[model samples]
Target chain A: MGAVTTPKQDRSRATRQRLLESAVACLAEHGWAGSTVTVVAEHAGVSRGAAQHHFPTREDLFTGAVEYVAEERSAALRALPVQGRTAVVAALVDLYTGPLFRAALQLWVAASNEAQLRPRVTELEARVGRETHRIAVELLRADETRPGVRETVQGLLDMARGLGLANVLTDDTARRRRVVAQWARLLDEALG
Target chain B: MGAVTTPKQDRSRATRQRLLESAVACLAEHGWAGSTVTVVAEHAGVSRGAAQHHFPTREDLFTGAVEYVAEERSAALRALPVQGRTAVVAALVDLYTGPLFRAALQLWVAASNEAQLRPRVTELEARVGRETHRIAVELLRADETRPGVRETVQGLLDMARGLGLANVLTDDTARRRRVVAQWARLLDEALG
Candidate 1:
């Protein structure tokens, strides 16, 4: 028999979603330091008690928010058409150049200061890395790239992540575009 | 005739240096938030009041620390022999694969959260980009490097900064070697 859907389970899921949404907004405006439980609760239109009931602690709330983002991002990434190296690189660039990436960047910066949040942030980052590597491996297979070239491509991806964060903070749009273009060129030169 | 060194000036310079050293050690041991004034003072064998006498606030301390680190790093980078594309890439990798690079990674992760700290980190980061571009322009001198190659190369350097942070945290010797090797290889291919 199929498992029954409990009312409590549904409500719990809603509360979790509320917290995650509230967290993204709060984190964007007030940054990590100002993103307290009370503030997030108010932002979410939920009571402090309800917020705590769901998240338990500020650290838990932040981790949940990041996990929520990563899951959503992972889904989007999975949906991208990874037919060839060019397509794959374009999708990865789009992912980094979008709003979701901005949110992830903000969270990472905030987590850098909070000692309790490091493990969670690091783990989420690792998971993202693994997913990206998997996509890269698949792209390599499709392109018939040598093993050494596949490894080199993964390294470029890592470099792209680091550059993307720096680019997001830049004020010059033209400059940012150029950075992404350079990434594409590097891929074409080394892997394509 | 020589210019006289006032006691106040000497004391100010000494206090500033102590605070920088303490901040470095504190950050190394405990990350960003842990580099509080109380801990810094204790680390430097000075009273809390003495540390405050030099740095009025934590932000000031952090800003001074960033500038001090930037100067030190710039000096080291300047000292490197970066005549050709290969030497340039090798010097860049050597820069990141050392203790100075580790210190930079620490400061970077810490600075990400505090918006006030962002400009300082970004400024130093931009300078690094500009310097790299200068070296690339001088070395490559190739007009065919698409309009924004310099900017992209700079962004890649920033990404290297983040990846280096991830690398240090993972504490994997193989990963570190791989990152540097890939970076070197990519640079060789892109500029060679």
Candidate 2:
């Protein structure tokens, strides 16, 4: 009985996973204006009814994408080896360099036009704020050098979003790296 | 003949100005997605034909709106009393506190969806970057102690944008004031 139940659960999970992956691909390729529920259904190789069953509307699909992107980002953050400051900076830069960041950027562009989507987008933002703030507060708690360091981290994160957008548009690796190192030093100074 | 020339020139310029103003208001009120050429024409109390004569398409109208917004921001920046760093910080905070910023934000949201609009948006961004960089370079040149100052100024400016956005959403005067002081201190450190 247990063996039979395990494969059944796995199949269900795989289906859900497939749907999420398809949504991200569709979002990146078409953006929100061009990515509709029917299109997503076609892209996912599922019936329209199946896509609708998973995500009732375009907004629901976008909401799922936002949550999916956040979970992926948080997972990436967790995988980072937080041994040194440089390590952390490298991890942060790597986070922005990958496909997930690109998909998130596409969602951000989509969210800008759709008022209904802003809440979902901002909800993820608040999640990042609180979670990132917790990490900053913990990191600085042991150090006596810099106070008000959490705000510095938050500011870096915010600026990095704009920088990330610029990176996508211009492909300026040097400037992006400059932003990362400069922000790291600022964090250290603030910590001190 | 002189009277006719003055009024004709003034009338033509006023029609152009009114069209621009109406575009901004329509954008702010209806968002970029909702604001159509017909809607802007209605807002300006002009016929659709007249609006079309002035702005051939929706993209052109939006382009005009962006230019108008940039000019408004420039005018505001010029009016700032650059007597001291503190006043300068106040001006920076003030820049994002009102309707113009809201309209600009709306356009940003809109531009993300419209491929045709992105170039116009990038041009504006480049113009602002160059102008701001020039100002920072000038200040750094004047100050003897500030070395590698451009990076610091740019980072501080980026941080100031986040602070200003927070201020706009929360009406948090105290927070804005603190950010202003922090910005001023950061500037002093970079310049001194």
Candidate 3:
């Protein structure tokens, strides 16, 4: 038999989804300090009690929200068109330089100092990082067993992240484009 | 005549130096929020009035502190022993994966959210970044006029920073060592 979708259950699920989305928005726009349950509940237009019932504490809320966002980002990365090497590099650059990165940056900074939040953030970051690496490998059709291939992948990801960090403070669009293009050329030479 | 060092002037200079060092220590351990003038002054074994006399405001304090730290780091980088490529890479890795990077990470996170701090942080970061890049270029003995040499320099710095970011939450020492070795190999291949 098919699963039943009762109105009350649907409403509960919708409320949880809203809270998660609101929490990510808060993190992206106002950073870790501003992403309180009360703020998220208000942003989601839900009652504080409802938000608490959905996510018992700030940790629970952030943990759920990061997982939700990571899944969304993973799916988006998987869906990217692999037309050519340049295209793949550009898409990865766009992905790393976007809101997902900003939201994750907030968590990274907060988790660096917050002992209670560190384990969860580290777990989520590792899972998401692995998935992204896998996607990049697949997109580039890179041979994992080849000498220097894995390091190249690591280097590319690290370069993207560094550029994203620069973008956090300055308008590094032109420089980022140039760097990506040059790296893409180097990758092409290496992998060809 | 050479500038005369009065006892009062010497004491004032020492207090300021202590405060700056304390500020960097607080940043590395506690992040930006805990690196207040009062906290730094206390950490330095100085009075709040003395801290204010030297710094005037939190912005001034942080700005001066960052500049002070950057100059110290620059001198340290210039003095690194040039044993070989692996040794240079290891030293660079050690430089990035230390307290300096942690303190800078705190400022980068704070500057991302604070408009008032953004300009100062951005300017200082750019200046420090250029100096670091110049040092890396010198260490690598890279030809700046070469087509891809500058990008290679930039790539190395960016990769170090990205690895530093990863190290903030996880013990990425093993992975960082592997990446640095692989990158050193690639750099040798390219530059040789």
User: Which candidate's DockQ is highest?
Assistant: 3
For model 2, what is the alpha-carbon lDDT of residue B52? Answer: 90
Q: For model 2, what is the alpha-carbon lDDT of residue A42? A: 82
- How accurate locally, in lDDT, is each candidate? 0.67, 0.65, 0.84
Model 1 clashing residue pairs (backbone): A162-B159, A163-B159
Instruction: Give the distance in Å from residue B88's predicted Cα in candidate 2 to where it truly belongs.
Output: 2.2
Best candidate according to lDDT: 3
Number of colliding residue pairs in model 1: 2
Clashing pairs in 3: none
lDDT of 2 by residue, B84-189 (tens): 7666656655776576766665666456556888778778866865665555445334352444455666655555544544433335566556546654665565
DockQ of each: 0.38, 0.30, 0.65
Pick by DockQ: 2 or 3, better one: 3
Ten-residue stretch with the least lDDT total in model 1 chain A: A139-148
* Candidate 1 lDDT tens digits, A1-192: 538768988888888799898887777555565679999999988999999999898988978888877887778877776476556765665666555665676667555556688778988888977886776666544343554565566666766566555555455446656665666666676655
TM-score, chain B, model 2, is 0.84
How high is each candidate's TM-score?
0.81, 0.82, 0.93
Quick one: ranking by lDDT, best first? 3, 1, 2
* Higher-scoring candidate on TM-score, 2 or 3: 3
- Tens-place lDDT per residue, model 3, B7-120, is 988988898889988998888887776678888989999999989999898989888878987898788889997778777877877776788788888888788878888899
The order by descending DockQ is 3, 1, 2
